[model samples]
Every structure is written in structure tokens, then in C-alpha cells.
Target: MDDYEAIRSGILETFERAVDAAGRDGAEATRRSLAEARDILAADRLRPVVLGEFKAGKSSLLNALLDDTGEPPLLPEAEEIATSVAASVSYGDQETIEILRDTDDGTPGLRVDRRGLREHGTEHGNPENRRGVLSVHIRTPSPLLRPGLTLVDTPGLGGPYLGHNAATLAALPGADAVMLVLDSSQPVLRSHLETVRRAASAVSATDTPGALFFVLTKTDLGGYGEVLADTRAKLAGALGRPAAEITVVPVSARAHRDFLAHGDEEDRAAGNLAGLTDALWAALCHRGVPRVLGGALDSLDRGVRALLAPLEGQTEALEDGTRRTVGELRRRALEHQARLAELRKGRAQRRVALRRRIDTVQEELRRDAEERHARIWDRFESHYLEEDAYLTDPQRLVAQLTADAAQVVGEINARAGTATAAVLVRTAAETGLAMGSSRPTEMAAPTSGDLVVRGRLGEKHRSGRLKRRLRDLSFGGSMGTTTGALIGSVVPGLGTAVGAAVGGLVGMAAGWASAGRDLRNEDRRLDRSSLRTQLQPLKRRQAAHISASVKDICEEFREQAEQEMEERIEQEREANQRLVAALKDTEDLTTATAGTRLAELRERTRPLQELRTRTAELEARTQAFTAAAVDRTAGGGAAGARKPEPVTVPGAAGDISWAEDRT
Candidate 1:
């Protein structure tokens, strides 16, 4: 849970929060997600997964750990998928992908084809020669499960069994806890080491990245010793270090049954396997799955905290707004009721009294709103802002709003002075317009072209989804960007209340100028927003200013929107504060005292119990993802690492106490 890990986790958590927000129906959902993300910063709940290629004996090793305790997973009797070659995990339900059907074998991945579990009666064997795809699940329940540990099961090294070899290879180095399986009987091949090298390059750490463990499987096979050297040499080559840099061990997993009977691995094959597991577990202590998950959790915590920090101060303000609005509404309603009651009391003058009362309130509404508009007029349509911004450049405002006449792409987000200026230029030659260029000040922007940056996945995004979104906001329609939504509820004549009022003044001047001398008697629509609002000229002008220019802003902001969005989100985080108030009243999350904080924290984490219970159930099932006999020596080049003996062999599945390594 060091700082760097914390940062990584936080960044990822933010992505999750953003995705959740994106899924919501309206901006309210976005706000809620932001709020949720803010709270999560204080409490982190993320598990860092330790994953790798299948036949890495990941299943058997986990089973051994499970067997160490009173609780052990029931490995499935059936088999599927030749070998996991995709990024595999014990749990995760969403973002579903199909298990690639095994062309080689009928069996692969999980099957839900049966109408019920009883469809096969008592038999539950795997489909044969399964390749590609495994299953999609959120979790599995293995007794050894805990919050700090997330164990993943992955596809094998070669391509076919699961899917692309690249997907599997790419996923390896990202693991905090890693173990490379080596077939003790087969020496490392040139192609094999190359794949491993590619996986290693993905890991990056400010200090040091993940550690590597070498497990030599199928020790009973004849090539264990010779292949071990090859495996070591290859890892050293990839890691740019000596053999000592890796942890190599030999194992024979088929001996589980034998060990159960004898309570020990007395045979050489069994002994080697036991020793391997022991050594691997020992070296794993420091870089255990727990530590990785802890780091992930810490990262989530920091992100949540940073996101929510702004709300702590603003909670009071939001509460005040809620209180004031509600109270005002109540008072007005009550007064209206009282007048009605008086009219009812005086029947003789009831009609007249009711009319008078209604008129009075209507007048008050008009007057109050009018007066408020006047008071805030300068803020929204301030001469200072317009003059300052215009002196800065009249073209800035239009650039932010419309499409550029010449150049199509433009900046969608306009700033405080409103949108950047768009020069709406016509070529001096074509329109004989004195404007510097023929380009429309506002350039068209890529609607969903690309706002891509490589984060966790190490994948590039050049898709069109979000680009279209921005494009729609810029050219096709109004109020599509996040900024637009935030201001949608704004009272046009009440501009001073939302963001800077300076832009309003510019619009007011424009409106006045457009109206000409008629402005004297013309309906003066102040550059202020009012409730029960009509589209005021002032509001339109301000919007116009912000979006006046687009080409100048370019696509720079879009590229950085993710970052800007995060910043603006926190900067204007005061939008909601009810939950934040609750936190502060409890002593700013630190608590009034230690005892109280502990209690509050427990209460806050009460929801976690449900999440944990769900995770536990998932852990159990995940452990059984793969529990069949694995021939670690099949692909490995090493002496002494045996081929997977048949169950019917004289001393095989039933009699052998072999602790085989399936690396």
C-alpha cells in the first residue's frame, strides 16, 4: 500500500467511477457517481489480482493452499478448455466474453447449456477439447479467501486453447504476484522465452516492479534437472539478472492422493513437489497477493479522498441552498394559503379578496424576480468582463460555440470568459469580408474521434463513440457537453449565481447593440437567468460568447478532458453536499476522538459486509476453475519431469503420492 500503488489504484477507481457515471441516465447520475467516488476515497475496496498462464499449475497450487486449512475447494470432475491462453480470473461477471470454443476438443470453458444441474444426473464431466473462452463470473468462494487476496487463473502459453497468445502474454507482467511455470522435463525453447520476455516488459515500477517465480512442473519426468537449467537461463536472460534472481522449484501434483494416504511425500517425486510448493510460498510472503491487493485498496482510498475533499467545505453551502429553497417555497405556499383562508372567512368579499390576493402574489413574483435580476445583472453581463475579454479578443467567445467555417475541428469546452472566440471569417477574397481569414471561427470537432491515453490496459483508444458525443455538442446540438448539463438548470437572468457573471455583460452589450436605439423602450432582457424562464437574449449572448470561437481552442482540451474533467469536478464539487455534511458532522472523518472514529468507520463500512459475503462465495467457486491433472513436462524441456501418467497406471492417480510441478 505504498504511495505509487495507491496512485495507480486511485486512477483505476476513477475510471470505474466515470464508467458508472457514463451509464447513468442524466447528469444527476453523474453527480451521484462523483459523490460515490468521493466517499470511496476514504474507504478503499479493491483486490489486486495475481494471474498467469494456465497449466502453470495455478489450480493445483491453490488447491494445496486450500487443503492446508480445514476447508478445501471441490475441484470439478469435468474438464474443459485445453489450456487457458487468455487472461483468466476466478471472478468477474461483467464485460462478458465467450469462452473460445475448442476446435480440437468438444470440451472447453464452462457450460450452461444444460437446462439444470441434474441434466447430467450425477456425472459432471467437462466437454472435450475445449478451446477459447472459459466463463464470466464476479467471484468464487474458496475458504482461503480474504479481502487482501485476489487470485487469478489464466490461459496457457500457446495460442489455441483459449485464444490469442498475445492477450495472455500481455496480461502477465501487470501482475503484482507472478509465477512462471516451467516444464521440468522440457528445456526452455527459443519461442517460449521470447513470450516470457514480452510479458516482463509490461511491468514498470518507480522503485521495482513485480517479482518472478519459477515453478518446474512434472518433476517425476526424466528431464527435471536439465530443463531447470534451461528455464533458469532463459529467465535470467529476460530479466537481465543471474539465476538467483528467480525462484525455481520442482513439483509433481498427482501425488495429492498419495500424500493424503501417507500424510507425506516420502518418494523422491513427491518430495520434490512438496519442497517446491513450500519454497514458492515462502518467497511469496513479501510480495504476496495480500500486499498487492492492499496496495490497490490504498490507491482507491486516496482517489476517493481527493475527490471528496472539496465537498467537505461545500456541504454547508449546499445544505444552506437546500434549506433556503425549501423554506422559501414553504413560506410562500403558507402565505398563499393564509390569504385563501381569509377570503374563505369573508364570504361577502370572497371573490374580490381572492382576486386581490392572487394579484398581489403574482406581482410579488414578478417584482422579486425582476429585482433579483437587476442586482445580478452586472455579474452576468458585466461590462468589465465583456470589455476585458473583447480587448483580450472578440473572437474567443464564438470559437467555443460553433463550427469554424474553413477548418472543421474546434475546441468544445469554453472557459470563464465563455467560449473561446471563433473568428467566423470569410476569405477577404470570397466574401470581401475584412476578417483575417475565411475560416469559420468555430471549427467542427471530432464527435467521438479520440480522447485516448494509455492507462492501465496499455491499449490505445481511437474509437468514435466519444468523439461523436463532443461533435454533437459542438455542431449538431446545444448543451451536450458536461459543461452544458451543469448549466441547464440555470436561471438565465440569475447568472451571477452560477459560475462567473462576467460573460453576461458582454451579451447584454451585444443584445443592446443588436436592438439599436429601440433599446430605450425595448424589453430589456438583462443578461441574467430567471426561474420560470424564457430564453433571454442575455443568456443566449453569453452562451454565444463562450462558443464564439472553436478553431483557436483546437482539440487540445478534448485530449485533456479526462484530466480537466477531474479537476473541474473537484473545483466545482460543491454541487451536492448532503452526504459531505454527514461526514463532517462526524468530525471530518477523523472522528472527534479515536474511539468514535473507529465506531464511525465500522458504521461506514457496514455496506462492506454484504460485499464481503458475496466475495467469499465467489472465492470458493474460483478455486475450482481448473483442478485436473496437468502435464507440466509436456511442453517443458527437462529430465526427470514425467509425462502425465494415466490414471490406470500401476502407480498413478490412485496410488502415486507424486507432488508434480505443472509449471
Candidate 2:
């Protein structure tokens, strides 16, 4: 355990108590938030995945890390996808291997894997992972494992397993850290660099910093020094990070294995494996844990603030008394209601106009998306298909095509997101007119959820079978987008809260990337013409699906907007009635209970005030933990030219024995 993890553990314990107290106080929302906070902090593992091109020694690096005690490598290493299956190695009381496979009912089940992993999880047996093997869990006694660290071995990118690309990309955001392994003997290609950028971009979008590391593997092969320098230079040019801040380390997994087995200092010195191990442990202790803890703290703080709001509002209402007569208030309500009725009539006419205009917008969006596909495919044919070698090599063809397809989907999703926002802005203008306001402002600043809608779409599709019934779909009904759910409880006001709801619809229309998965490699030997001929049907089907889905989503948004308008009007009417009644009854109540309501409100808020104060203290601790972790990593105490110090585990009496890098 790192200091951050220890602090998080303390926070979790305190938050659990807070949940109990809140439940007792009947603060249901605060209790729910605190319970969620407990869940987030209960998991102790840091999942730092190893990702890269096929045959980059990713598995070997992970095996070396897992077998640090001179044990045999736990994972099978081969040059094919047959040995890759997104294996995660963690600590266990008893050594065990659990294979998580999807059942016929589509839910995952764990089966003991005593024989081998290849039969259930390899590409040859479960090709394209279509056999339903989700993940492999390996348990070991390595001291590194004692800190609750899980090393994930992802399938190689740009391999024959196209689905692996989607799976890996989807998993990137949840990773505590990512190690992008590269073959140091070769120059870093554009694709490899792009892989790093994508991972960094995803992490940064979530506001998590320093989650990416570059690993230059196969150092024993020689001539890697020049390659390492060049790769760093390119990364600096590409990512705009200070070269010093970007941690790129070199290692040889074979040499590390040799050193561990025989205690060969020469092998250890040559591989620098000890240095890599220390760096990894230090990062887990110093960077990963603090960042995660900080995020959780931010979430908890927001929940507490939300709880405090209503109490404060009620207290303030009691303090002020600009009471108006009940009759006057009722008249004002009727005037507002009449204006709302006129607005509704205007909205109905506008809806008809917008509905007609929507078809034109959809057609324009579809045309734009198809043109993007045409451009990408044109490039693919001109560059890749023109080469006889690309056609002959199945792996090469599959990898290139998979990359091209994902790129096209990503680009189209972006365009669709933009177009969807435009449709929404146009639709909202009518609502704005009804409310006697100017043009509506934009929704909450677009989260990564807005830009990468397909990521969420793919997650939703993978979680269940999305039936074709538009009304039955969550997006089609009232659930709104993922962005909407995040704000549904926190933000107040009709326009502000539901603006996020409308944004969710925009996300759904734009981010439907699950369709790209329909492209497969049943027969990988097809030439360019045959491939294009084969894909034409999928393209046509996908285009039609997009059109229908977008249509349904837009229709749903219109309904939600109308429903929101009505709900807002009703809320205003009801609130005014309550105010009128309160004013009419106030004279009698003041004689009997002056200041009584204010006293009760203050008493009710005492516990909440205490929780808020405690939350502030936890926030300070979270910041301190982050700052301390950053300082440790920055001073060459973690990873740099100097031999990295062994990261001390929290809650331990002394250091476990892998303190010095034998290198």
C-alpha cells in the first residue's frame, strides 16, 4: 500500500461511518453518495495495462514482473494471438487461475482453469474472442502483488484479432496506468505513436494526469539506444510533454527471466529489469493511487454540497418575508400559465416545421458521414490494396482494415456529434422563444463522453442486446444520455438540468460505433475488389441503421423537450400556490410559531454542516497525498537515470526484500 492508498483506506472507513450517520439522519442522497464512495475505495488494486503492437514482448514484460521471485513464467508467450487474451495477474491467498467466460445466457461465469488458458481464451480456440472468454485472472505470491497491483496483458494491437482492438480501446479509460511497450530495435511508427496519443488523450480527457509510460523492450538485442533516443524525440514532438516528464525505460524480458532464475548479475545488469520493477512499484504508490483517490474525493465533495443546498435554501426562505397576498400570487400564476399555453401552441407549430427540417438535416448528416467513409476507403484502396503483399498477407490486411474502419467510425461519430448538437440548438431556440428568452446557451462543457460517444455506445451494446424497438430503448424513452445521468441529481433548475438531458440525445445519435464491429474476417484471403464487394452490404446496412437510430433519437428528444416544458410549467404553478398559501396563513402562524421554523431548520442542518467540514478536511488530505506523490516521483526517487528506490508499501513494518535494483 502506498501513502495514497492508506489515506484512501482511511477515507473509506470514515465515509462508511458517514454513510451510516447519513442513513440514520434520513439524508438518503448523501447516504447513497457515501456508499458509492465506499465502494470506489474498497478496491485496492492498481490496474496498469501493458499495450502495444503484436510481438512487442508485452507478455514477456508482464511475466518478468509477475515472476520476480525466480518462479517460472505464469503466462504463455507466443508470436500469435493464440497466447494473448487480456490476462490480469493479481495477489491471492492461494495460487489460483480463474477464467471468466460468458455463458449461454450472456452473463459472465468464472471457471477454474487448472489445465491451460489457451483452450478457453486463445485466438486459435476462441478466435476473435467470439468464444466468449472475457478475461483471465492469474494469482501469484510476488511481493509486488502484495500491494494490490494487477498487471494486465492486453492482446497486441493491429493483429488479426480485430475485436481485440475494440476491447483494448474500451478498457483504456478505466486503467489506473498504461504501459505502451515498443520494440526498440525498430523505429517508432506512426501507428505506435498514435496508440500512445490515444491512450494519453483518453486519460487526460478524464482529467487524470501521468497515467501513460513508454517501455522500450528487447534492449539486449543492441542498437536500441539510438532507437530509444529517436522515439523519445518523436514523442516530445508529438505529445508536447517535456522529455524529462515522459518516462521511457529500456529492458529485456529474457534477460530479466535469466537473472531471476540464476541470480546472474550480468543478466540483471544487461536487462535493467530491476530498475523497471522499481519504477512500476513507485508509480503505483506515488502516482496512480493519489490520482484515483483525488477523483473519488472530488465526487464525494460534490455529493455533500448537493445535500447542503436544500437545507440552506429552506433556511434562507424562512429568514426572508416579503410576503404578497394570496389572491395577487394566484393571478400572477394564471398569467404565467396563459403565456406557457401560448408557448405550447407556438412549440407545436415549430415542432412541425422542425420535423420537416429534421429530415433534411438527417440526410445532410448521412451524406457527410458517407462521404467520410468514401474518402477513407478511397485512401485504403489507393495505398494498401494496390500492394500485392498486403493482399497476400492475411494479418496485414486484417490489421490495416480494422484500423481504417475504427478511424472512420471515430471520425463519423465526431461529425455526427457536432451535427446532433446543431439540431438540438435549433430545437431549443423554439423553447427559448416560448420562455421569453434569447437563444439557449450550450449544454455543460462537453466531457469526453460528448466527443467519444461510440465508446459509451459500445459499452452499452456489449452489456446487453439492443433490441430494434426505439421506444423500448433507454435513449428513446426518458433515461437520457450518460451525461444526463451524471447531472440529474446534482444540478437544479429546469433548463440547466435538462440541457444535459438533451446533450445525451445528441451523444446517442453521434456515437453509435458498435456497428463497426460487424465488419469481420471470416475469409481473410480476399483481394481488394472482393473485400469491397463484401463490405458494401455491411456499409449499406450500417448507413440505414444510422439513419433510423438518429431519427428515433431526434424524435425522442422532441418528446422529452415538450415533457420538460410541461413539467417546468406545472412546477412553477405549484410552487406559486404553495407560496400564496404560506403568505395567507403566515399572520396566524407568526403569532403562534415565530422563529420556530428557522430554529428547526438550523437544528436539522447541524449534522450536514459537520459532514461538510469533515469533507473539507478529507479534501485537504487528498491534496496533500497528491502533492507528496508528485514530489517523490519528480526527485528521481521513482524513475530516472539514478537507480530508483524501492517504493515502500503502506501498513507494512519494513520494506519487503526487493529493495535494490540488481541492475
> Candidate 2 on 557-641: residue-level lDDT in tens?
4465455445434433343343444444443456237388668768867876886677667656655544444444456422332
Each model's total of backbone clashes: 129, 1
Task: Give candidate 2's root-mean-square deviation (CA, Å).
Answer: 24.1
The TM-score obtained by model 1 is 0.35
TM-score of each model, paired residue for residue: 0.35, 0.56
Which 10-residue window of candidate 1 scores lowest in summed lDDT? 647-656
lDDT of 2 at 333: 44
lDDT of each: 0.35, 0.56
List, residue by residue over 1-663, the lDDT tens digit for candidate 1: 132233334444544654343334133433454454445433433222333343455445444533422222222112322232332334233222234343556555443322221121112233321222333222334333322234444445442232223234334433444556665645577546754554443232101222345566666555566667767777778767656445566666546545754676365346355454333333232233223232223223333333333333233323434445434444543454454345335534533433343334334333432342343334334442343332233222222111111111111221100121111111112221111111112222222112221111222233553454444334322222223334534747434334233334334444444444333222122211211032234334433333433323323322232232233333223322333333334333232353454454455334333323333332222212111111232223222222221111010001111121222
Q: How far does residue 104 in candidate 2 sit from its true spot (Å)?
A: 5.5
Clashing pairs in 2: 1-650
Top-scoring candidate (TM-score): 2
